[model samples]
Target chain A: MKWLAASALLFAASAVAAAGGGTRTNDDAIVGDGFAPVLSAYGFFSDAQAQRPAAGVTPYRLQTPLWSDGAEKQRFVYVPGGKQARSRGAGLLDLPVGSALIKSFRFGGRLIETRVLLHRAGGWIALPYLWNADQSEARLVLAGARVDLTTPAGAAISYAVPNKNQCKECHGAAGQVVPIGPKARNLSAEWLAAFKRAGKLDAVPAVARRVPLWEDRAAVPVADAARGYLDANCAHCHNPDGAASNSGLTLTWEETDPVKLGVGKRPVAAGRGSGDLQFDVVPGDPDHSILAYRMASLEGGISMPELGRASLDPAGQAIIRGWIAGMR
Target chain B: MKMTTALIVAASALALAGPLHAKTIDVPAGNNAQSRLQEALITAQPGDVVQLGAGRFALSDGLSLDAGGVTVRGAGMDATVLDFSAQKGAGEGLLVTASDVTLRDFAVENTHGDGIKSKGANNVIYYRIRVTWTGGPKETNGAYGIYPVSSSNVLIDGCKVSGASDAGIYVGQSVAITVRYNYVEQSVAGIEIENSRDALVTGNLVTRNTGGILVFDLPNLPVMGGGNTLIEGNMVIDNDTPNFAPKGNIVASVPRGTGIMVMANDGVTVLGNTLANHGTAQVMVVAYPKAFTDARYNPYPRNIALGYNTYVGGGDAPGFPGGAQLAKAFGGTLPPVIWDGLGGPKALLPSADVKVLNLNLPAQGAGVDQAKPALLSFTAPPMIAVPGNVGAPARLEERIVR
Candidate 1:
């Protein structure tokens, strides 16, 4: 009878292991024993390149993507056990446990890095994977990488992959690791409809605010373009509830207060980041504005967004400069 | 069941043996050095030491250590350098959030923001570290070289810092801190202890900054009620650098050429320091109500004792405006010690509220306004009580270096 009991216990333990309940080590490697693989013996995005949900993952795109040193980005959201994403009015909905956000960054069609944000029981953990030169498999990169690449505009730029802890510098809100983009204000109508059609969304809001793509120059006013760029790039840190809340600058889409929106506003703790410019934004003068000064420089301590870009964003800069020049 | 029990017993035996061994992780020097260092930090066990090889490692993102009792040592300060001139991620060059962590013998240069920042971490030590921005002082430099905020039991020794837009070495909202044997230059404020309690700052060489050293208490921060600080045995000289801090920052108001400026703090003893060649007054004591917008702060500076310091070659090219009280009092040449005399009604008494005793200087080196009235005289309302127990008085004996 004891021998029969021991056999039953061994069978149960094997069953648990097969069910993905096995122990996993927390290390720097991206591929762990029980981790979900990025590609499944097929080409990149073979299952669902840019369409509906496939293989427990849903393809998504931001209406206005954050500037990342002019790199091309593709984003995907994966929900474990086929759980759907609930809808909210303002920002991103609270995701369920075991959810993952995967973002792939490519420079000049060359895959550079893939970042994964996994929502676990503890909190959101950021994991970065650096793609090999052959573009086959990406390995986990716990420390960041510095790659010197030339931009399409023929400018030499050094691209940086953020380390895991550096991820929290922008993702942290109220001391918790949270997602920055994918707000209702930043979701295109067609994308929202696609999520609804695929049965991935619980409830779409009645009226979703839209921030027009800055590239669609004719559709968006110059001011709206500048606001959209700032909202996508700087609002993650400069918003009232964001990481730089202590600075008293809020760059959210809905911010109405001129001071909080950085209109003629002085920086609180900018130190040398002010670039000797008096105001964060100067009306009718981007030349003398601290905002433009920080955006134009790559060598100084006064860069905007303070991270994730080695080269200047000329398109974004032009829009903001035009807006500031048009202002009375 | 027998096999499972036997496996568990073996794991338990291994766990018991783990504490007996100390792990040493030697990080290889290469382009992926930042990632390897971070990986080692993440996987480091207690009492583990992570050492960096001698080379210049270019890092784009900042590194962090969240594990307690971990030591990160590098091959001497200049030998192992972490260059963040092209940093693309993270605000601080290195941020530490774990207690009982020691970082030594490395140089962090040209970070996007503060060079090394510790937030709310206790028992942290930074020894023989050099933090610098390669280019000369620019308005676009990083804010701080060494910044520790809201921490306790901190020691920063034998460090060299320069080219910070704000303070080269700044300790804010902390307790039981000791900052000594550091060389600071080319910053706005060389060394600053702000809104802290029980700090001992000594044996530091501060030069060519906007202000040599400052002790201030500002309102609306996580920590307040700064007092009982001792400043002694330091060289503060030739701090004529222009203030380039942003307008809204409080440090922007500090005039250039100040050796030491104490503002709205209490129970500070300035002793045994050498001061020289400041463009403004060597030392100035002032109130906060004139400068700050916060209503909850204590505006008055009381119980300030200035004693036993050597002063020379200042009182030339005063930076205060011509109409300012300080400019009028000293006639464009400031005395070694000048008090603003704005400490409310209690300042009217004949007693020495701001004392200067036993200083080996000229007779007219110090000036106090006996009849000057308080500026903005109504009594300040009570400060809002904050949560958490007040930190106990850190005994002076505990701070003495044996």
Candidate 2:
């Protein structure tokens, strides 16, 4: 009888936990709920959390994640301060859910173009549209609807970034799909929501919430840094099915895994001649290393990752250097 | 008849007693070059020559000469046909494992792999020879026409080759190899020298293939590209298309699509060659300094000379966003030096394949005429000499057959 009572209590607790621990607000869930309940509660908390003014009053700003065009349509470029909008061309971003995307902010001018993608369970797929930019006119093609919001309501509806669309192609595979890499792109919204429920969001800095590469040092290990750099730069051609497939050096994160691929072979004859490096990786010394030499060399014979935005990123190179330096 | 035979034997004895500077061996119709070669091996000793007649004669496979000082020559390439088509064996055609083996004016055809392979052999001279495969110019052909690896002091002169998926003429891990007066065409690579010490490539005509010429210092090899490798006075043009093997081959795979691709190589001298009409670039040099084992000791070649050569049709403009800029981005600078007095010139290895058409395509008409009256300049070799597309026209040639 006593055992039955104990078991019943345990079962009830587990059931409650399974039902989101009664922690997540109704709006926190992607399914079964709208944002009203959580929005009202958060609004109340914002009021209480507001601190009193000490000196000169500062301009108040409340940034929201929404799109003026509609909830179904995702905006590629959202200039928060300018409250401007842009759209990629047609058939660019019909991406599968959970795919990775990378966007580049090429121009320093007014309008910013961003590329979006989705990381699906199978592989990286592109969101078939692209954002084009001009001075005055902003439009979204294929999906039909161009909304440029310069007012407060417009800014409130724009999608919050540090989003995947900001750097989709920058880390894209093939043409514009976000392939798997040494680093993950963005933390899933569910994971972020889970952290919010666990009260870790306030502690996680804005910087930590940025892209995977820009996240706090705690997010990734040093050993994985080289893989991240290679993926961002060289994986396009060094894989099994790329133009450089004959070289036999698959720079993909999965193929380059030391134990599995045995990339340590001195000569990769299967590679033909491109990656016929003396050593794939030396325990110590990056300067004497062939991989490092290719990365550092500016010559056509040695420079690596063939083509893209041109020139190696100094910061990214340094990160890879550090990782190589760490290898014992 | 017996008296005539005795008089002939007496004359032979007298000839043997004379100062034997140039040795000679007679090869008749019934007895093949291999049998005569065996007899010559027994009698005349070192510094002897095996002279073969002009005839369609077949030979066995796996003939290696570990000893130095032997010469194998034929009356002419057309007359002395050595067909190894029937023998499907491993190894190369006419392999000289030792040094000082001189061969001239013989046609070696249908070799399973490298037609003429000399490994660790030095002071070898192959002159006026034709190394070929049975197939015609479609690429799916032979491995290498004249392949010399880890050898030294070699001279390849007046040879004609084609139909190789790899380099029609390849020299690797060697030093002091002079390649001149050879006609190579319609192969993966026309001439390739890799991981050698010091070499010279001059006065050759190479055209209408995948890549033009290449000097590479691959990793794990004992030697890198040699210092003072002079590539001069050659007509190298139209190394554009990919090397396709045996017309209907289902398994031969060659990575064509570039012209002159130089990767992981250093200290080369490229001078005075007419290059044209490439699928990708006129010249491409890809180096991997980080991947080098002894980067400090094995200094990356600081010198690459590209001068006084007519370059034609790489499908890119002359200036800024073209081949020159790409070269700088990769590590090479434009306006490479012309020449140095000794043998080779000085220049920088290109970092990327440069697309430049310094000359017009097809090489016909008065404006584009490359034919100089003096000695006809260059010759177009027959496609049967080189078979497959294992190598590029001017790059490293590799063929691995299971």
Top DockQ: which candidate number? 1
Compared with the true structure, what per-residue lDDT tens digits does model 2 show for residues A68-87? Answer: 11222222211112111111
What TM-score does model 2 score on chain A? Answer: 0.41
Candidate 2's displacement at residue A100, Å, is 71
Weakest ten-residue segment in model 1 chain A by summed lDDT: A24-33
Could you report the Cα RMSD, in angstroms, for every candidate shown?
A: 8.9, 27.4
Which residue window of length 10 is worst by lDDT in model 2 chain B? B393-402
Model 1 over residues B1-402: C-alpha lDDT tens digits?
999999999988567535566578898678666667787887676677888899998886677876777788888889999999876663788888677777889999998788998875687888889999889787667898998876788888889999988889988878988888999999989999988888888899999999999988875444677877888889998999988776656678788888998877867777789999876768777766333334456866767766667888786766755424544554545556655665653322212222221112112212333333222222333222121322322432232233
Candidate 2 lDDT, B103-134, residue by residue in tens:
78788887655577776667777788897766
lDDT winner: 1
